[model samples]
Target: MSTELTRNFSIIAHIDHGKTTLSDRLLEFTSTISDRQKQDQLLDAMDLEREKGITIKSHPVAMKYKAKDGKTYNLNLLDTPGHVDFSYEVARSLAACEGAILMIDAAQGVEAQTMANLHLALDQNLLIIPVLNKIDLPAADVDKCKQQLEDILAIPAEDAIPASAKNGIGIEDILEAVVARVPAPVENPDKLLRATVFDSIYDAFRGVVSYVRVFSGSIRKGQRIKLFATGKTYEVKECGVFTPKMTKRDELVAGDVGYFIANMKTADEAKIGDTVTDSTHPCPEALPGYKEIQPMVFSGIYPVDSSDYEALKMAMGKLQINDAAFTFSSESSTALGFGFRCGFLGLLHMEIIQERLRREFNMDVISTYPSVIYQVTKTNGEEEIVDNPTMLPEQQVIQEIREPMVRIFIMIPGDYIGDIMALVMEKRGEVTHTETIDDMRIMLTAELPLAEILIDFNDRMKSMTRGYGSMDYEHCGYRPAKMVKMDIMIASEPVEAFSTIVHRDKAEGYGRALAIRLKDVIPQQLFVVAIQACIGGKIIASERISAMRKNVTAKCYGGDISRKRKLLEKQKKGKEKMKAFGKVNIPQDAFIKVLKSGD
Candidate 1:
């Protein structure tokens, strides 16, 4: 088939808006997957995605659709993730296509992420087809959704196709619109060998299997290809397209979306967003590569058993090859021993990575509380970025500490404005602006410290709005604040893992909460255990775990009262000596329990 007959596009949407379901319906309608092979989220190959009902990685498949125009066109459909943490996946998918299907839930109307994704698509200048999904449900208001599209997105209401991905309604209409509205890939006249690598995965047998879109040339078996980024060359062991499964093919020409096995042992050799060109006939210039993605949330990941440290390292290396947004470095903790300081795009991304390590590699790992990056300026005219609380300098050495800030757009029903305002204020966030999205809905723009919203802010917003709130945010640089490093001490000894950077105003409250939580989780010792939260020399909050007293007077019931008193006196003397010299053994389970609990 010629390049003009190929249509490469992606389905982009918010979480749980039926993006995967629509992909399934399209695959079924096109007869791409057989009856026996049919399943929900067919493109979602990961076990995590199936259990969570969300797309984590971008899935690409090729379909030969016979349209009403009496022509069979090749459709390359990339099913992308909807969650905000995985937005990078959607961006990578969008780079491989010329068009996008913007999916929205009819009952929920437009959302914060919906607009975020739309701007991403627009940035790439891709043709977008607005879609109103789940139209068959009783609560689905198609008219309201279309109006939201028109007013907010600026897309004409009539352009959006209304259908239920669950019931397979209007599948043909969507395909027809994609065929008519989406432009085909234009090939370079010189026909130089060039391709864009959208994603890559590691396989024990196949080496690195890269998912690529042929832009101006072709790739075939035994062809020598070079990665522009690394300047490394590899022999293409195999080249094939996905029918939801890799199928052998003779050659992949221009405008083709498929995988190529290049016998490259590691993912570093073939990086995501790298340009691929033939070794023999390279293109004059490489395609403009994607912008680098930086992680916003940081945490420490350590194995429950110290012996599994090396195994955990190997698992992290393998996992990092598949995830570009995850980062890790070797670090030692006084409390957890040796571990890796890991960085993630958000809390969900960190959680998913931990879950994958446990399930896929069978490594028992524990993660500390999540934190955001901080900018610290020292008294000697030096500046540094610190992701961990342990890396923060002393109060006298640090001239000022600046926290990462984000501009957030929250969409919610009109009734919850006051609640949202209070929640934002509590998090040390300021509402910059507000706009009425519709009669029943409003959008609030706020600037907040990234660390304040890392854990339960989203959950709280949803609860306050009766499940009608959504938020999307972007980094707005750093701002100077009165920040201090609060440490949690057990028996007057500092535990590095439990330390955090907090605002001066809320230091007492946060410290009290953490100290109380620690007291509940930490086991009692023979000596009294003092769980204290301290800011340098001063302790902001403290909790005491009373000593476990032994019954020394039980055997002297028939003896004189003075004799019983003598026994008690000796017991008290022993307790005092123990408190002076005994070491408090803090259980490993205590750290795990406290770290796992949310704020």
Candidate 2:
């Protein structure tokens, strides 16, 4: 196919804004999928995605569309995730495309993620075709949404196409606009082979299958290709494009998006964002926007059974094949045994990975509370990056500490502005700006510490706004903060897995609540279990679980009152001895339950 006849574009939108539905309709209109095979969210092939009704991964499909001008165009549609946690996936998809369809809900004019993605697309200088979706809904207000597009995005209401992707309304108009408005790829088949590997998947039979967008030259089967970043070379075993499924081809020319399988044993060998080039003819430098993704939240993942340690490691290795954003290092905990200190972009990302491990790998795992990375400087002028609270140095050696911060954007109803502002202030956030989107809704921008909103913030926001508020954030580097390490101890022994770094002002309250919750979850033992929260050997909060009582005087029913009292006194003496010498056995559920306190 000629480069002029190809269109590479992506559908970017907020969560539940009809991106997948729109893609399905496009596939159907172009005859990419037959009517008999049509289904809701056809691009969401994973069961988890179908069940959750959201796209978790970026899906690329090739379609042949016959435009009104009587020309058949090869259209590549990249479907991206809508959640903020997967914003990185959206960035990767945008980097591979020439244009994007910015889909907005007709009822909900503009959301936080929609604005975030729009800014990113503008930054890339990609042609954006603003689309207003879900017009069939009774609540949808097309005119209001169009005005929002005009006022906020500066895209004219006339230019924004209104359509209902569910019923195939204006599907042909979208196709024509994509062909005429979105530019074609700039072909350079004469240059050296240069392709960008946007994504990859592991196949047991074919090794690692990498998805690439050919920018310059052509690649064929049996040709040797080298990754620019890793400097590893492999012979291309097979090459294909997704006709919604892998369809083998003889060769892929410039301006093509497809997959190629090499004899790569591991997915790490061909990293995402790496450049692919012919071994004999290579480019001068790797592609742009290729950098390592740093994780923002850290947690400990341990197997329910200690024997599954090796299995857990194997499962993580397999999971890492497709998801290279998260990182893990082997860690051992006295209370939790062998585990991994895993890092994630956010809470949802962490949850999705854990759920995938359980559903796909059939591994029962326990994840501790999530925390952000901290930069700690010591009195001796040495610095360290602390991801796990237990790894923090002694308080005497610490000189200064810095915590990660994020610039959060929230869009909500005007009625809830006061409540939202109060909530932000409670989380140690400073309001940077506020603007009125319309008479009923407003947009708020605040700078908040990353640690404050890692958990429960979204839920609280939803509750405070009655589910009308939406938020998005990006890391804005770090700021100096007064922090303290809080530790949980049972029977005088510290539980490393339960340690956390907290702001100095809120440490005492958090510690008190944690101790109380631990008391409720821990069962009574032969010896009293003393749950204590401490900071630098100073006890801030404490709770006690009474020991189980034994009927030592049951045998003598009619005995004198003094005899019964004596027996009780003897039992009390025995209990004191047991409390001093015996160890308190804490159940695994206790550890899991304490982590759910939103610490």
Candidate 3:
């Protein structure tokens, strides 16, 4: 019989490197999901994640594996988020396990993000099992990839497991490596229950569902546990594991990953990195972890149709239930009608959430450009949250206006390095270091302001490099930088909702492009509309829409006064159905044209 030892580990890979598909095969092998029902990527339970082909959050699952030694071991698998925007979730997931199965796409070799993740995993001191995935492809270069992995990550190359996660080859070897190298959890039979809250999501009925890693002791249903950080205690109403699927376990002991329900509702109660302890004898302190995340990108999300304001608010609330990173507050606007201001982890996260809101919730939204939070010191030496572009204080009156900056890493073909460098320069990015990864690929390190890449930066990068360049960035604190105000003018007056803080160097290009784009989208209306870019009180540029002179005509009474009134009634109804921008009402395509032109 195989030994009764257990292993708790997680599979972490860059986006789309077969992590989910491999997890599915493991689930099928253990019969968690039947072959007939196994579509693919079983642990990607979220409909949005599965449909988007990117894991926005990490999910924990449990499975029983039968080894060749004829022994059964419980495997707790955590599938982590792959996007850079979700790296905080990834770190929490890694901390939950004693080992990590790092899957590298054999054909593509190691990527910039793959290296970043590897460094984070090393810092955790988890046993690393390097697996070369997608070996079934003809272009797979196992030997070369092995050499690079060893050279780059300083790990053993010969030990790298080559397997097709799609076809289940070498999966047994992967399990064997885990059982051999990964240490089993140390059980504390006498100690009170303690678990780490790796991540949490909100459920309508359950409040917050905390996914925890049981560290030292056993926990049972109906037991009272205290969340150390928040000093909140609640009775466990439910407990279960991802047997590839969620399987209810009456009691989960040390060395297992599971979900528990604490009627201690509210998403803020069970914060990630907090510890779970017995309520009767609480732990002295919470677990040591990274500091709480601070939002670096700010944007305004407005409802396109004012009539759907209530629906948009409800939809945003529902979306935030699962996405704790989203910080929002409702505000009213004459221009936007009504909407909420949103803070995001970064630009990508902002875009992803916006797209999700539109596609899944069917809510049409107008998003302002992503701007970084400005550190404004008042005359009394106090601080405030200033996100609006027009709200900036005068340079002389300001004590200091600090901007957030980050360390950016990019991997691109050598031939496209110059073009990428030029783009970065235009964004006020400064190169810190450059290294050659291979004859074809080069790695660039730069310190860039977060606001620089908030707009069509991603699209522009892809277009310039022909999709051969990719980048990842982490906030590196703040710096003193030149700042300019971007004003969105409606008619001839500046709209407070449209102002943003941008680096002085980039203001002209971005402002001009936006003005041009708005000109096309703002539509011809009953009155003329003008789009202007301003720095402080001065308008730098403007784009105007000619006045619409003939959209309506008056009708006289046709013998009967009521008959003429009926004709006017029809015209009023038609005008009422059109979209209103400022004082002008426009047709449907007007708004659509601005979005499509992307000027």
Q: Per-residue lDDT tens digits of candidate 2, residues 218-321?
A: 88999999998789899999998998999999998888999999888775696989999999888877778555788999999999899999999988887777
Q: What is the TM-score of each predicted model, taking all chains together?
A: 0.97, 0.97, 0.87
* Alpha-carbon lDDT of model 1: 0.91
lDDT for each residue of candidate 3 in 227-253, tens digit (9 for 90 to 100):
877787799988888665557889878
Instruction: Name the TM-score of candidate 3.
Output: 0.87
Model 2's TM-score against the true structure? 0.97
Summed backbone clashes in each candidate are 0, 0, 5
Query: What's the lDDT for residue 159 in model 1?
Result: 94
Error of model 2, residue 497, in angstroms: 1.4
Q: Write the per-residue lDDT of candidate 1 for residues 471-571, one digit (tens) a residue.
A: 99999999999999999888878998899998999999989988998889887887788888999999989899999988888887595799989998998
- Badly placed stretches (over 4 Å) of model 1 are 554-569
In model 3, which regions exceed 4 Å deviation? 1-4, 188-190, 305-318, 359-362, 377-385, 523-530, 548-599
What's the lDDT for residue 163 in model 3?
90
Cα error, residue 291 of model 1, in Å, equals 1.2
Candidate 1 vs candidate 2: the lDDT winner is: 1
